[model samples]
Target: MLVGYARVSTQEQETHAQTDALRNAGVGFIFSEKRSGGSMAKRPALEEMLTKIGAGDTVVVYKLDRIARSLKDLLIIIERIEAAGAEFRSLTELIDTRSPAGRMFFQIVGAFAEFERELIRERTRVGMAAAMRRGVKMGRPTAMSEAEEAEAMRLWFTGDYTKIALARRYGTHISSIKRAIKRYRERHQPSLLDAA
Candidate 1:
């Protein structure tokens, strides 16, 4: 029995192409979804497909990355398939776990995948650090504007609004409101550094 799995990282990505490829490969049953490959928990279809496999069954996929986000994840899924007495196959990469050479090649591919991921991560960190060095902020923009923070601080000081109320009004968190209040107090109060 050939059971296929197809996946896309986002809803914007089309899965029909992968589905067609899997079907053309003579896969009778296919499970597909648009879900992030970042983690197993994010892909329910993949999890369900794994549970349905049995001895002599071959699990097919369009590509390795469609079923796995990282080398560790790929190995984990392959281990499960092997434990279930099933085989694994990738259409594009032409990997068939039934052969000894294919198994060794799969491991090599995993090593290359891990290496590629590390390179990407390193590049991203270096780029972010460079942006920061250039005085560019490198995170989500504040939900509450500076003007809104000032208004929240004023309202908080007037004792007219609660922390939760301020957060809801400004579409922010109670923690953010607290931080704004703290900043307001620090600015208003005389610091020891200023005294010195």
Candidate 2:
């Protein structure tokens, strides 16, 4: 059995080209999904295809990167396929992992993928650090202004509105309201240990 998997990152994208290629390659069962290949949990069709394969079966893809986000991820998926006693095949890369030469090519590709990811991560970290040193805010901005937060806390204490209602009114979340209240008490109120 030659089981195929095709994927695209977003709803606007289509997997038609990949599906056509896989079909032309004579793959009998092709699973397709329009999702970013970032997380394993998000690819249920990929997981199902792997789980359904058995000995003497082969897992096929139009391209290796279509199914894997990084080298570690690709290797992990191959490990799962191998554990199921199945072979791995990629059409564009001409990789058929049942053969020694094909395995070497796969390893070389995986190494380059891992190196590329590391370089990207290093660049992002350097950029963030540089921004921080220049006094630029690095993360998400606050959800509420000081006056609004104060009013929300006052309303909460006076039992005029529930946290959910206040969140809706302020266009924030219950979590933000709760965090504001907790911070306020921690600053002004004595702890039980201090009272003791």
Candidate 3:
């Protein structure tokens, strides 16, 4: 028996192409899902497929990355398959772990995939650091505008509106309302450094 698994990172992505490839490879049963390959815990379909595989069964995937993003994860999954008396095969990479050379090539491909991911992470860290050095803000923008914060602060001080009311009025959470007031206080209050 050939058991296939296909995956996409998000709901916006489709696994049609991968499933088609698996079917073309003579896989009669396939488990497909839209979920990140970043973690094995998040992929229930992959887990189900692994459990369904038995002796003399081959686990097939359209690509290696579709099954796992890191070499450690890839090796762990392969070990599980081997332990179940099953083999592994990848269509795009032409890797079939039924032979010594095939297993070696599979590991080599997994190593490259892990290396590429590390490179991407390193580049992203460098880019974010450079942007920060240039005084660019790196996180999500404030939910409330400066004018809105000022208005919230003024209303809060007036004692006419409660925190919940301010949140409802601003269409933001109570936490945002509290933060706005906190920012207002920080801006207006004289600090110890200023007193010195």
Candidate 4:
């Protein structure tokens, strides 16, 4: 049995090209989905297709990314297919894991995925370093002004109010107050050491 799976990120994006390719490849059953790959849990048709496929069957996909976004996810899906005693194939990538050459190709792909991740990490480190050298500030914009932060700190140090109370008085969440307290303690660590 040759089972096909087709997917598109949005309803506006057509699946005709994928379905047509699957039909041309002689798929006996085609399970189509219209959802982003980011939300794997929301893919009902994909889950159903996996449950329905059995031994001696082949699950065909138009492309690798159409089924899964990352190599980790692709490996997981491939592992599931193999565990079911079935084969996996991608039409565009020409990856047919049922064949010996296909297995070799998969290994190569795995190496490439690792290499790509390393390259991304290196590039990100370089970019961040460059940004720092240029005095570019990172992280989220401040939710509280300097005056508000000072007032919050003063109230907190007085031990007259709980963290929750301070947050309520400042019209902010408790989490914000907690973070502010943590930051203040870290900044004043030298003073604390001297006092001790």
Candidate 5:
């Protein structure tokens, strides 16, 4: 059996090209998903396909990066495939783990992928640090201003309005209102452990 796996990193992306290539390669069954390959635990389709594969089966992917985000992940996936008595194949890389040369080449490519990821991480960290030095704030804008949050907390304490009602009044989520109240309490009152 030739089982294909196709993945795209984000919901905005589509796996059509990968599926088409896998179909053209004569793959009978193809599992596809629009999810980040960064975490193997999160990709249910890939996990299902792996669990279904048996001896004499080949697990195929359009590209190596589509299947794994790092070398360790790639090796772990390959190990699982081989342990199931199944072969691994990458369409674009021309890698087939059935041969010794192919396995070596795949590991080499996986290593480079890991290195590239590390480089990207390092660059992002450096860029963010530089931005911070220039007084740039990261992350999403706050849902409410401090004064709004304070008023919300006050209204919450009065018990006249439910957290949901407070959220509606403030145009924020209930969770945001809860967080504001929690923050107010934390600042105004010390924890039991602190008193102890």
Candidate 6:
């Protein structure tokens, strides 16, 4: 049995190209998803397809990245397919994990992924270090000034108004009001508890 998997990262994207490719590859059953590749949890169809696939079956995908974005993720899925006594095939890359050559290619790809990750980490560290040397502040920009935050806390501590009412009065979101109050309480908490 040959089963197909097709994925599109966004709801607005079409899976037609991948589906058509899978059908052309002679896949009898197809599972498609319109979920991002960042999280496997969002792809229910892929999960169901994995559950249904078994030994002696072939799982076909249009592209390697269509199945998974990272090498580690690709390896995990490949391991699952191999453990199930099934084969994995990628139409675009012409990879067939049932063959020895294909397995070697997969290892090569995994090495590149690891190299790429290391490069990314190095680049990020260098960039952050440069930013620190230049005294460039990083992190969320304050939506409200310190004075506004203090005034919001003062109003809240007086117990004269509800959170929603305070938010409406100050023309700020209720969430902002709640966060301000939370931060204020955390900062003013007794030091005895901190020692404990």
User: Listing every candidate in turn, what is its Cα RMSD in Å to the true structure after a full C-alpha superposition?
Assistant: 4.9, 4.0, 4.4, 6.5, 2.5, 4.1
Candidate 6 residue pairs in clash (backbone atoms < 3 Å): none
The C-alpha TM-scores of every prediction are 0.74, 0.71, 0.77, 0.57, 0.84, 0.67
Clash pairs, candidate 2, are none
For candidate 1, write residues 125-195 as lDDT tens digits.
Answer: 99999999999987767668888888788888899999999999988888888878887887899878889
Clashes counted in candidate 4 amount to 0
lDDT of 4 at 78: 84
Model 3 lDDT tens row, 138-162: 8878788888888788889999999
Q: lDDT (0-100) at residue 117 of candidate 5?
A: 87
Alpha-carbon local distance difference test for all models? 0.90, 0.89, 0.92, 0.85, 0.91, 0.85
Candidate 4, superposed: residue stretches over 4 Å from native:
1-81, 90-94, 168-171, 190-196
Q: Score candidate 5 by lDDT.
A: 0.91
Model 5 collision count: 0
lDDT of 6 at 108: 80
| Candidate 1 local distance difference test against the native | 0.90
Query: Model 2 over residues 1-196: C-alpha lDDT tens digits?
Result: 9999999988557888999999999999998888888898889899888889999999999988888988888999999999999999999988999988999899898788678878998999999999999999977676889888888888889988998998999999888888888877888898789999
Worst 10 residues of 5 by lDDT: 177-186
The full ranking of all candidates by lDDT, starting with the best, is 3, 5, 1, 2, 4, 6
Count of backbone clashes, every candidate in sequence:
0, 0, 0, 0, 0, 0
Top TM-score model: 5
lDDT tens digits by residue: candidate 5, 96-132: 9998999999999889878988999999999999999
